[model samples]
Target: MTGSVRAAHTALALTNGLLIDGTGAEPIRAASVQVDSEGAITYAGPDSLAPEVASGTTTVNVGGNAILPGFFDCHVHFCLPGGAADIGLTMALPASLKVFQIAERMRTTLEAGVTSARDLMGVDVGFRMAIDAGVIAGPRLVLSVGIVSSTGGHGDMTQLSGINVLPYLQSPGCFPAVADGEDQVRAMTRRILQAGADVVKIAATGGVLTPTDRPDDVGMSVAEIRAVVEEARSRRGGVHVAAHAQGRRGIQNALDGGVDSIEHGYDLTTEQRAQMVDEGTFLVPTLSEVMGSLDPSAGPVALAKKALWQGKARTNFPAAVAAGVKIAAGTDAGAAPEHGHNLRELGLLVDNGLTSMQAIVAATRHSAELCQLDHLVGTLEAGKRADIVVSDGNPLSNIQLLGDPANILLVIKDGVVAKDRAGFLTDRPVSPR
Candidate 1:
């Protein structure tokens, strides 16, 4: 082919691919996708009806590969390393080292076919800006800067310290803050927004990761949660709050407080599930975290937690599905098994009672809706960004293909091909770390 022919500025067409658009519809066979110079999909369907590719256009022969919308990881931490607690006293490492660690995590995430990620906590606004400016090779980011919690609550870093230490000398980073009362909660929420958070995250319940609190304990009061919701709404951005709830009362409080989504509904009751469906509240089960905790090799704490909670998750999952609760996918990446292996969440969802299609939707369209980014990403359709992933085999037949990056032949983000079988090649190279 001539150099001019190879250097196209117009449409880039992928022909003869099996298309799964992430809309819960049946797959389309022998399809083609035409992307314009502006990165919008101009046409997608049968190759026979695809718009003509003018001169100097690029073409890719998909050879019957399965093309689907890129995956989204709803719960991730871009600024914090995955095993932060494991680092112990090394947590005192300079901020720059933390930044580089995050950069590497982003690259690994993208390489694994996650084109977009919603960082639930511990990501600064500066990190988001860096990714947006193409200074880092990371997924599109929706970040919650830090978490707000009551004194000694799930996010209270103070709990991790020894009793001999003076609390006044402590200066917390992005992990969590100990705020109390409605006014304090409101102030903290605004502070997070002002600090560049896309959404405000609050610990409505105790957590498994933190040393002191029980996962079932209600950590934040209804007034505190409401203060955050009200303040966030006044900004017109409509803040989305992710509640790390694991108990019935905590779930109730989260729903009543106008939390957009409940993360890890480990202890929610049938009544609470029905209420969630009735109130239009979304649930993100984060099945992979449960599964990871069950792995005997994952260590005693994780294994013990899983042994205690797995039965609860098993009991709750089918009930939530039966109750018609809107479930989304999130793995709590960075908590265990790291960031890049997010797709393991999908398989775990399916294993936990979700049909393969439902699990896929939870990770894509449902996740986008939860993140309020459905208009920009999610389903593959005309006028949407050309963020696509092509796999060597049918992912529906075996979701495990998603867990391994090698099975993904292509990954495109914003109409730019970020990864091919040959490896990373782009006009603008964003350093991984």
Candidate 2:
């Protein structure tokens, strides 16, 4: 194509492709997309019905690739891999090294076709902004600086060994803002919001990473959770909160406290699931982490975590689906199987109860709605950002193709070709060789 045709202002037509609009609508074959200079899609339909193209606009022939809205991961930690216990080693590295590691992971994730992600519990807002400004290549990140937890709770980094031990090393973002009373909780919530967090993350119960506490033990009192929620609302932020809930009581407490979504909900009761439906709360089941623990090659800590919570997750997932509770996909990457392998969560969701389409919806549209970004990038609709992905085969029939980055032939972000089969638009080499 000529330079004028390749970089035009009117529309870039992508013809001869199958389009899944991310609205749970039936797929349309031989479709074309018309994107404008601002990155908003202006048209999408059968090629025969497509609007007239401008003279100098480009037309790409996809050759029958499957085009769909890019995937969204709701819960992720951008930190480099090391077990929960080894996070201390990351803290010992220079700040520059840590930033480099985070950037590398971001590139890997973006190249995997995840165009957007939510940082569940990390203080990487600077890194998030860097990606957005084109200083780096990565998904659009909605970040939550470290989570808030009670002393000795899931987010707490204090080590216990018969006698109270000194504080061990912890990653900058790993240390929870430990609060006790309701007043303290409210203050901490305000502090996090001021730090540029897009949402609030709270540990309502103990977690698998913390060896001492049981997953069922409720960490924060009802008063404390409510206090934090009220504080978040007072800022006019609509600050969504995700609770790391496991036990029945903890799940109930989080729901009653007005949490937007429940992270694990492992061991959740039938009554709790019903209440979730009534309250319009979303359930984010990170099943990939649970399944990873079953692997013999997994670390002892990961295996222990899976052993403790897998049965609960497996039992409750189907129940939540049956109850009509809104389910959003999350993999809790970096906790077990590591980041960039988020698509495997779809298989676990399918094995649980959701149909193939339902599972895919959970990862795309539902996840965007959960993050309150549906207006921006969830679906391939008019006036929405052109964040699209093209895979070699139809993902609706075989979701496993998503797990192989090579299968993703094209990744377009904000009207720019971030990744093509040839390479990234930037000078940097393509990953996943």
* C-alpha RMSD of each candidate structure in angstroms: 5.2, 4.5
Provide the lDDT at 279 for model 1: 79
Q: Clashing residue pairs in candidate 1, if any?
A: none
- lDDT accuracy of residue 38 in candidate 2: 70
Query: TM-score of each candidate?
Result: 0.90, 0.90
**lDDT by residue (tens digit), candidate 1, 261-310:** 89889888988888888878889888877656433545677556667777
* CA-lDDT, candidates in order: 0.76, 0.77
Give the per-residue lDDT digits (tens) of candidate 2, residues 283-380. 99888766564445546875776686887787778989999999998888766657777777777888899877888788889999988889898788
Q: Per-residue lDDT for 431 in model 2?
A: 36
**Structure candidate 2, residue pairs in collision:** none
Worst 10 residues of 1 by lDDT: 1-10
